[model samples]
Target: MDVQAVLKLADELVFAKTGKHLEYLEEAILRGTIQGQKYSQIAEDFHLSEGHIRDVACELWKILSDVLEENVSKANVRYILERAKFYNFSTIGNDNLTINNVNICPQTPQSPQVTQQPQETSTQPHIDLGDAPEIFRFYDRTSQLTTLENWIICDRTRLIALLGISGIGKTTLSLRLIEQIKTHFDYIIYRSLRFSPTLNATLTNLLQIFPQQADIPQNIETQISQLLNYLRQYRCLIIIDDVQMLFCSGQLAGQYKTGYEDYQLFFKLIAEVNHNSCLFINSWEKPREIAKLEVNNNYVRTLVLGSLGLAAKEILKDRKLSDEEAWETLIDTYQGNPLWLELTASTIQDLFGGSVSDFLQCDAPILDESLQAQLDQQFQRLTQQELAVMIQLAKESEPVALPDILKILQLSVSNLVNAIRSLVIRLLVEVKEEGKTTFFSLNTVMKEYVKNRYMR
Candidate 1:
């Protein structure tokens, strides 16, 4: 949809709800989002502070949320507007809903069950992958890739999570997979939860894509019911990325931020309830409910992504390292994380003239200024407890018992346990089993990072 068309629809909705169209700055902010401009850029254009732009966005999202009866934010407002336009043209004022290519009207019985129909192009699948990131140079993750394909295409898994640390290629893998299997669904939508759009807002944006029923549900539960109804009626592949954004920073990893806690029930229902649709999430940290529900549910699976093995040599290849023999050692030291390799490769090239051996001779210093900057961003997201736990764990030469960690930190046992758990979730700490006990240790890179920053 054109940006102007979206704004027009938004204006109409806003007028209907609040008896006023969007103000000029609101429209500008909306336009900035539509154009994919950063708030900093938008602020510069408008002679406003980035914080002020955020305030404007909050107000705009709130107003749109009120009008649409769903949470609306800069990240998702365009999608909602586009889907609402489709609803307006096709089914909003009508009574019937399209179920598996059959239009069920007011007279038809609403059945909890649905029949599977052959894939046909008669009804176009409502696809709105809003600014889905591009697949740029994905390393070999063939087995994991195949698993994702089987889960979505053959097994028809309803909810699947792709879990990994940041820059471990989750986003790129998902993009490639979506392109491969997009035709299998009647509807395809992708949204980033990076900015923590409200679950209500996300639901509304998705609901706008489906054929609307005459009596619209106002509350979230009813709205979710309507979405479930559509999921049962049509094949939807909804991909939500960066789900960790919904989680609260500076707290336990699984806990949601205020007002986002409802997302737990939302995801739980999507996993447990019957629906012909699949919900795919790409996340840095696992949600609490996902951990519990995925235990016995084959329909729900979480794939943990580790560093690339031999394929990580691709980074060295790209960087044109002078010593090919040292690539394996370099890859191991950095755990084959593409982002880390990308950053480290450059530092190696600049300082050691692309000679990995020369770099290795220096003992692979873990905390380069650039890589430390990256770790800093992730570390900043940790709670005080999590950060303190990392500090103590970094000092240990080997995996230490929970009691050892407890001895160093001035925290109660429960709090210490929670902090360690949070650290584990953030992928900052690793667990080793010795005899019957589990011990905690920081990865080499993380140890250097925490030691450099906290100890020094």
Candidate 2:
């Protein structure tokens, strides 16, 4: 088989079995193998150990066997490669396989003829939000929307917390909800506390949403009280995105030694004592004080937004593989985070032969700021040893088993276990089970971020 044909078969086999395309090492081995190099010679040329070459060869056999639905050996591997040469595999590096080129291939009497058809397009109305169109586009979370609407319109719950990791669409959902229900409120305001506003600055911004008659007070407490009074008289919806910033160690309601103490009092007053409604969206754990507020059933509601479901995947059917199984695998890798999916989908379609799983498994850059911030915060919280372990996982071609991690880190079993458990709680790592073996991988978005920032 020619080098190109061998590479194509290797790519397909790797993706079909492990949801990852051939990496640099695998590609090098395939290139050398196609040039008629023996495994030992290839190992010596690459300056790798003999065992490493044998391991790669064995893995290649397994992958090809799975893709071909039959056991593959060194002898059959060449036969499979020859057969693959007759069938063109869609690949990124080669550009000659366009639809027009397919038309000129000579047809044989026994060969079935196939024609390409134009793709259908959707006419769904796109919501535009100026420079940030994605901010208003509702990707998923239908259940959260229903629950939010019920709380606002029917139950009249005054304060709601929309909590989730970054890029899970908390801010988008809040904005979409406000666009739907703003007519019901006398005033609507969206505030981003991501810059960690102080009490004076927060109150100053709040005053802009009120009428001139609602005179601003110099004192923070008085201003807040007056605002509540106005809210009681008039229906209002206030949204605070990135509330974690406001509660960070030194600012706003998060200013107390434990972060903002008075902010908790302020929220309690707004939700329990006053009639106004507020939406708080954040990436981290809710303040302990807010958890206490759950006791007051009539005042507040909390919605933890999760990944997008099957319905949302339909929105991008025209752009890529458009296959149900491929879409599901992509979603599972990204945990259905909208920003990650959108960013990944286009790239997956353009490169990697429309293999979403392969694109995800391959190292890629994170383009979303929210995802980056979440990863930064989590990494900042780790100890040096913990960070070391994380880098090991990130560098791995696949998930690492517990024993492998210990061996790689040269740490005692207990210490390794403790580090893994800590990462699990922090949502940075996830455990995958395959029979008796357990493996750990950095969560999808985080994996790329950590690998880029620390590993390489």
Which structure among the candidates has the greatest TM-score? 1
Task: Report lDDT per candidate.
Answer: 0.77, 0.61
Q: What is the Cα-based TM-score of model 1?
A: 0.71
The C-alpha RMSD in Å for every predicted model, in order, reads: 18.9, 25.3
Model 1 stretches with alpha carbons more than 4 Å out: 1-114, 117-126, 211-218
Using lDDT as the measure, which candidate wins?
1
lDDT of candidate 1 over 1-456, digit per residue (tens)? 588877866665555444466899988988889888888999999898987787667656655554443446666778877876676425433554442244434333333222342232346667788878666677788778767876665455788988888877888888778767776678888999877889888888788877777556568898888988888777788989999888876778878889998888988999988776789999888898988998977679889888888899987898888888989988888887888888888988888899999988986654578888877767878888888888888888889999988877899999998888888877778888989999988878888888788998
**Cα RMSD (Å) between model 2 and the true structure?**
25.3
What are the per-model numbers of colliding residue pairs?
Answer: 2, 5
Q: Flag regions of model 2 displaced more than 4 Å.
A: 1-136, 249-261, 296-298, 318-324, 353-374, 381-456
Q: Supply candidate 1's per-residue lDDT for 240.
A: 92
